[model samples]
Target: MATKEPSFEEQLAQLQQIVNQLEQGNTPLEEALEQFQTGIKLAKSLQNKLTSAEKTLGHLIDDAGNERVYENNTDDPSNNGGGNRGFGSGDSVKG
Candidate 1:
């Protein structure tokens, strides 16, 4: 039998626990180093998951039921070409 992989939430919680342990300043140097490395790996895995989700959400279905890449309407008067100012630019999602 194979071991089941932890879900994203479980991995995030484990990373938080590791951070708390490191912050308490009670663990020995070697243990602390090990936890720190594990935390880095978990963080990277979480980031990759988020990026993949964002890409998936970049697709949309129109009224005609045609699948198309989502496009931010920067030309709208209210948008003022700053629709994606804070988040990543719309061009980041390529079809």
Candidate 2:
């Protein structure tokens, strides 16, 4: 099945609409419960998509158009906190 490609705003709006409809309190108990389940699924799917997208796109950039990629050197014996990880005030930046 093809998942809908909805922007964050659009998904949020749909979620709100579902909430509003459920909140009106006029639907039958069975229908209300079904709507609630659908809303929960929508919320979970939206959350997961947003989180994955964030992780995929998360990054730091410099004024010189350099991408900052940080690698932990904890396993290296030379890295003993003797410096500030060579990152500060854009002087010693990442990447």
Top-lDDT structure, candidate number: 1
Give every collision pair in model 2.
none
Question: Which residue window of length 10 is worst by lDDT in model 1?
Answer: 73-82
lDDT of 2 by residue, 1-95 (tens): 99978887887888899899998999899998988998898899898887566444545677999877433323334544233455452475459
Report the lDDT tens digits of candidate 1 across residue range 1-95: 99998999999999999999999999999999999999999999998897677556767889999988775534354544345664455556658
Q: Give the runs in model 2 whose Cα sits over 4 Å from its true position.
A: 1-4, 60-95
Give me the candidate number with maximum TM-score. Answer: 1
RMSD of each: 9.3, 10.7
Q: In model 1, which residue pairs have backbone atoms overlapping below 3 Å?
A: none
**Per-model TM-score versus the true fold:** 0.69, 0.53
User: lDDT for every model?
Assistant: 0.82, 0.72
TM-score quality measure for candidate 2: 0.53
